[model samples]
Target: MVIVFSFRKDPNALSPVNCWHLILSQCRQESRDHGALSEIYSNNITLRLSHINEDVARLSKKSKEIGVQMQEELLKVTGELQT
Candidate 1:
């Protein structure tokens, strides 16, 4: 792909070499942009995973606390029924 830059006053158009340079420049810029976007996406995913892990840990702790409480209540009720 190439672009011909010409004007009415200027008879000279863009050379093929210049066109290739422009194309390569645009390609390099696009590659950099893609790399930056990929990095941002990866960071976001890592952050979200960290948050999820923290939430899971918190829920697990709460579940254990509830389990202990239930066991205590059951023991108390059993003792009352025996007496």
Candidate 2:
């Protein structure tokens, strides 16, 4: 199974979170079906699946941080406009 995820910068709101969820879900499913934690580690694949999993986790965390920052900026701008 192959899934592609794209991220776009949204000035008004956070980017889609579902992409990360989809990737994580797919990784879990593949791990279960293959009966191994690191299949790409042993095989010649485009990228090491194990490393991809780690990258996904890191990206997810960064996305959350970016979302929070965007929300804060929006709130600040709204407050300034109100005053």
| Residue runs of model 2 more than 4 Å from their true location after superposition | 1-47
Highest-TM-score candidate: 1
Candidate 2 residue lDDT tens string, 1-83: 99988877676663467667778899999878786635654674545676798999999999999999999999999999999
Q: RMSD (Cα, Å) of candidate 2?
A: 29.1
- How far residue 6's Cα lies from its native spot in candidate 1, in Å, is 36
- Poorest 10 consecutive residues of model 1 by lDDT? 6-15
Note the Cα lDDT for every prediction shown.
0.93, 0.81
**Pairs that collide, model 1:** none
lDDT of 1: 0.93
Flag clash pairs in model 2: none
Model 2, TM vs. native:
0.45
Model 1 C-alpha lDDT per residue in residues 4-30, reported as the tens digit of each score: 977575336677877898899999999
